[model samples]
Target: MKNIIINFSVMIALLASCSPATEKKVDKKADSTEVKVNAIPAPSPENNTVLKSYIPVDLSTLVPIDVLNTKSTDVYEKYGIEFSGNCYSCDLASLSITKDTMIWTNVCDENDTFKIDDFSYSTEGSKTIVKTSERTYIITQIDKAPIYELVVEGKKLELNNKRVSRYFTTKKALSLFKEHDCGDFEG
Candidate 1:
């Protein structure tokens, strides 16, 4: 009986020494060897389209303002446009230049003419700038199309030409088909 009690007591003490304590302790400093997660952002719809590079060229390098103003010039033209969404209307807009006049016509046959001398002309790098009392116009010639940047007060708006060459020569040499539905607007 004495031997049995002694062995049992020894076994209990060994187990008690080997077992973990019930108390819990938290460290004040954060662990350095923690697992980190890096999140990647989702791709946007606008990022999927191919982007075109634009390099501005000097205005005078393409055509001198003197020659352009000497004759009636078609500054810009846009036609055969179909609006998106609920707007199912087709519209057109045009800008024409003459010796001492500038004319613009838009939807609903609204037209406006202004005198050339009413605006001051200057060139900044590749842009030909024309400034009025309240508005500023930046014109850049690109290939057949010219881009127009209009600045009023502090707001800026941009517009581009749709058609540069509207005359087509038939293969049969029948006649030169001219695009006149847009009117006598020419550049």
Candidate 2:
């Protein structure tokens, strides 16, 4: 009886070790297959989807003299421009361009704003105000039309040319402008 119990214990230990070895082999195979799948080449830039074209601009050149005369919010209100294209909207506000990336803040309202922090080159054209940003905005200057293209990360986003009226009374529109931080209105 004692010999049989010892034999049973040894067998159980051997089976446990074998199971782990089999599992390790399976895991190694799966890892190799995953590596092989990941080795496939990504698409070339030329074969990539349509991209937006961002023209680097000098911010100093676009700053108007009148900017000092009025509040920043008022200045943006007087000259702010937006673009609509495809199904997206883009507002052109304060733009800072670096060697690698262009930092653009969209003046959505008098205050509410968002930044396009990681914009790079794209195939789509840009539509911008003549004196606001140095980049020429090239979309039909109509009430509703597709405007410029802004590429964030690797994705292309369209800027529609939609002007916000100075006399807009909608509560949402008012709130958007107030929420958008346009820097110091006094300075």
- Deviation (Å) of 137 in candidate 1: 0.7
Which residue pairs overlap in candidate 1's backbone?
A: 74-186, 74-187
What tens digits encode model 2's per-residue C-alpha lDDT throughout 77-154? 432222221113434344334434433334443243333443233333333222122233222112111112222222
Best by TM-score: 1
TM-score per prediction, in order, is: 0.29, 0.26
Model 2 alpha-carbon drift over 4 Å, by segment: 41-187
| lDDT of candidate 1 over 1-187, digit per residue (tens) | 9999999999999887665332211221222212221112223323322111122322212211111122434432221112220022212333444323344433223432222346555544444455656566555443243333333343333323221122211122211212213243332
Off by over 4 Å in 1: 1-92, 107-117, 144-187
Q: What is the C-alpha RMSD of each candidate to the true structure, in Å?
A: 17.0, 16.5
Number of clashing residue pairs, candidate 1:
2
Please give the lDDT score for candidate 2: 0.35
